[model samples]
Target: MAMIDLTRGLRSHPVRPPASGIARRRSFWERIHLDPWLLGMLLLLMLAGLVVLYSASGQHLQVPIAQGVRFGVALTVMLVLAQFTPATFQRWAFPAYLAGVLMLVAVELIGDMGMGAQRWLVIPGVIRFQPSELMKLAMPMMVASYLCRRELPPRVRDLAVCGLLIGLPVVLIAKQPDLGTSLLVATAGVFVVLLAGLTWRFIAILALLATAALPLLWMNLHNYQRQRVLTFLDPNSDPLGSGWNIIQSTTAIGSGGLLGKGWLQGTQSQLEFLPERHTDFIVAVLGEEFGLVGMLAFLMLYLVIVMRGIVMAGGAQNTFGRLLAGSIILTFFIYVFVNVGMVSGILPVVGVPLPLVSFGGTSSVTLMAGFGILMAIHTHRRLLPR
Candidate 1:
């Protein structure tokens, strides 16, 4: 035979198309791991947020610009995270969770103080970040990874171990006096547990125990934390102090009837009646400027995104992926629910931002990164078999 059979050789060793041709076929954005539906939702939310922020900031040109910059940075993080495969996330899951705990410990040792809470760690001349935010993402991953390794309908021991894993970070965060984040972090882990097939009997027992311990828990709360609970009961109790924000926010929202007073015409925001109009209470501005119509539209968009996220979770290739994606979606809805409920005078103000609509770079980035993990679960090739 000849050294090579031309047709057989060519058939056995196929050549890839030219690099230039391949490059021309797909742009960087096209190659990135992102769901177009989710991306569209995010972009629309940002646009709505910026429009509201502009009016909320009294039409200050720079405010929206700054928010836009934060969005761009967060978007970059999401896209980069998307490039990672689910296997990579799985491999890194425990390590990331451990690192988050170590960071929480570091925060306890040398965290910075701001707004009367030790929630952030800021170097004298370097970066500042919140360990709790890291926990928000890490908690679910750790729980999912551990649970997936065990049998379905985990035994008591598995549940105990899961509780320990969750409680450790919660205690650390609560010690930081950030009740909001501690609660959220715990919920994130718990969501994974429930979705992992934890029995309902245990859930009900826990609920009963929690109810029985409410008085004790109340006593354990810090003065301000206790005040927030009481304030939720009666805003008029401290209207000039803790309650002023809630009172003002409700007024702003209620005043935005049918079609609102027209854009940039909200007396509550423009006249400076609502506090934190650009951040936690931005939804109040939306309610004031766009009226009921605007609020409903925004809610619809948020619901769709939440549903899509849940759908992705159910579609995950493996158990870990399912638990993680589902928890993230549940936690996201919790964020939105808590913020809106607080502003609407039903829930206590927990210092939660309105998810993607709030003017918080840290929260925004953390959320987008979580979505990255979600996209990774959905887009990555089948890793572990079902």
Candidate 2:
């Protein structure tokens, strides 16, 4: 009876051959279509950004038609980026980081000057773009990938190497005088390290070392940089010059009260009392127009998005998946915090843009790229179910 049962099982079916060429490629496409929530967020953010951009760009755009065009371009780029998988990104991670660093190196050498900083690269009739923006994503991926191979709870030596990798681009970016982005990249790298189970001892040591470096870093600051630090301590000291932005932003925020001045009718924004209304200070616009209720809702959206990323990272099947998702999410938190801090009087003005709310083609596209990677990690994590 056992022999007859074994024969029947063996004869039941024959295994098929592996997929090859076009058939294999078709299977990949089918899987991506099965999951479109990733694409959904990109669409949502793009639409929201478009509305905010038009409202923010009102001063500059008489008709605001160009704002729509920019969003259209950004949306197309985001959709194209969404199609890529984490594995596809893994293959190109090192090369992309290398290229990004080289571009920064080139920017130091022959880049165009802008806003008193040498950070833009212009190619003939094409366009100008910031290399540092690429670092926003590349630095995290490169550092996380390097440390992912190590055993959990990395050693001091391992952390030192990681710091060096992080510091190189950060130093270059700071040299460009773009302190905001430099800080963001560092935050992203450090978040990945912390998530990898860094001990409190290492965290304490890092705090001490950072404190020790303050004087040396202080000497390296540009004059404007020095002014920002001073203004942060006492915006009242220079209420009309270096501190004008913060003071005005504060008034706009305070005047909002409970319900705010109403949308597009913000006296500060309409009367042009607020500086950078559409960009770094958009929070002020939201606060002035929509009040605390709007601010709370916005905060909740950020919280939900960040928590979702944490969930995805925790559930990731492997080290790379976990690190990638965690780093992106934390960097996003930095963007929100820094932007809000700058508008408020808490943090120094470092020129960090409010994530989806601020206006800029490069930033919007870069943010979408990071979000796409989060999708990749989340989707892949579910497949492995770790």
Candidate 3:
């Protein structure tokens, strides 16, 4: 009767259809909405990363095959994670944050150190993963859960608590001597705080304090870390030593000219002249082989992902969902920005991979897991609890 009244005389028109069992079945499936465009952008980036990895690896069989296997595994992980909602995530956020912190502490006590950093926990007959990677998701979840119960802007005391939460992980990661991951995690946490409407004055003060501490930070940094900062200022100062990576990267990028040197034909990569060809410096390989056009396409894909994330954040119905979505988006931006900045010689080389493109299973899997959480957040934002 209500439907008849709603439709009024239109119900008598030919457009009206009879409700049947088949219609009900169709409705059920139609109600289950998925964001295909965002998912497509994600898949495209991963594919590009895989293709680039194949190109960048000097020993194609060793790096490319392992990367392909890991990419498949990461896809499975992403699928599993995509099934859960943000509220389900909220229940475990604190525990996940605590566990991640404990793992960081454990690394200091009993971790397998490699390349001057105790960043991985190698379990027998299992995966060797970085605990710091978990912070990419957990930190945002932890911060979002805290900020959701408050007003738009938080109080000073609330800000202090946020600072402490951010500081603990940053200090632990930095002590791992992994300055890059630590910076990314710090940015992830702080991004949520800023999105929660922290005051402009506080942000200004924070920047000023960071600048003020640079001299002090410089004094305490490890020699190599310090060298990176100085080299960033002027790569030519030590072109054959600490500055070699950036110089090669810039030269490769410049030598690509308008189009490129062609696939599998980069002199810098093929001749074994470029350092870290398949990892931190992979972008240089890409620049040399695919030129500015390919670089711009890559950036466009990244921009699509970023914009889609912002849409998810805006579409979110609750504070936690909004903040979590925004945090992930911001963290993604930092990853791209740092990689490009370092490769372009504007920032120091601090060992950050170019998202899915680098030949690192651990990082690739972790990033996919984070994206899965984002999908879950976005998909369940407006759904009613069954």
Candidate 4:
């Protein structure tokens, strides 16, 4: 009777499956350290971007085809990086950051000047790329690596060191006169600091300092940079010059109404009324052709990606993973917000592109690589002993 009672008790609770069995049950994506949800959303966004780019480029098949190639390359890079563990990324973070900073310094000394900014480094026929874009990923990785080793709610001394790490790259990038990338890099590093359980009092103090430094920042701006701010305040002041982009972009978006003019049918783009319709202002092209419904649908996709990122960050097993993932996703949100706001004429035209939707390779590749890190953080978590 005693033996029977014990057997009944043992049978009452089911046993957990062996870890090997769980490992075998992982899907192909899990085995490869990829997040299907995040990957699927990114692919969908890239496909949509190609479709819009086709129209924005006046039905140029070659343009979308080239962009497709870029997406393929970016996805490959993402997949390869995702295979790495978070610890691997933590190990490489400082060296990658140091290399990136060295490249930025190299750019300052001998960079290819184009469109009034010395932001690109050209190595003859080998490759031409922007170091500022590299800093976007490095910034978060570095700050997260730095803080994860220290205590949470970092002490003032630690914060100061983190600040110096962040400020160096920011100052270098800003010297490139690429305000958009500089601010993005700065935001990336700041996100990590904020995610490290920063006290609100410290945050407030930093905010006050930033506000006080605005005048100094303003004084250092180039004439064109200042002009962008003035134009944001009153675009109509230079109707045919600096204001043309905003004026035309707003017109494109407004004309789309609730159900857009239909794909490849926007007058603002097809008739050449809109400038930069394929790049920074691509959202205007989307709004003009897809209308309010399309815009909402597109934004809903972005919202889902951001939500998934938040979920992944919450699930991270360590501080480094959490901080890196959180900062990447938040910076991605800023990318969308700033581009859309600039196109809508609410913010200064800072040349930020809509993530995955803009017609460019460097930004797209950098963004996908960041997402790869997020996947590594989320998918490479170790199972607990049962």
Consecutive 10-residue window with the lowest summed lDDT within model 3: 26-35
Two-way TM-score contest, 3 vs 4, winner: 4
Candidate 2 similarity to native, TM-score: 0.87
lDDT accuracy of residue 102 in candidate 2: 94
What lDDT would each prediction earn against the true structure? 0.88, 0.78, 0.84, 0.93
> How high is the lDDT of residue 386 in model 3?
28
Best by lDDT: 4
**Candidate 2: tens digits of C-alpha lDDT, residues 1-386:** 33334454555566454678776765564466222444455456556655555555655554245545665676666556556666667777788889989999999999899879999999989999999999988988887788877878888788888888889999988888798989888888888888889788878987999999999989999999999999999999989899999999989888888888777768887788888888899888888878888788777777777777677667767787788788988888889988998898899999998887787778877876787677666665433211
TM-score, one value per model: 0.90, 0.87, 0.91, 0.94
Cα lDDT of model 3 by residue, 121-199, tens digit: 9898987789999998889889889888777799888888999999999889999889999988999999999999877
Sort by lDDT, best first. Answer: 4, 1, 3, 2
List, residue by residue over 28-102, the lDDT tens digit for candidate 1: 434676777888898998898888889988899998898899999999999899888777777888999999999
Clashes in predicted model 2: 0
Tell me how candidate 3 scores on lDDT.
0.84
TM-score-best of 1 and 4: 4
State which candidate has the highest TM-score: 4
Per-residue alpha-carbon lDDT of candidate 4 for residues 215-293, written as tens digits (9 for 90 to 100): 9999999899999999999999999999999999999999999999999899999999999999999999999999999
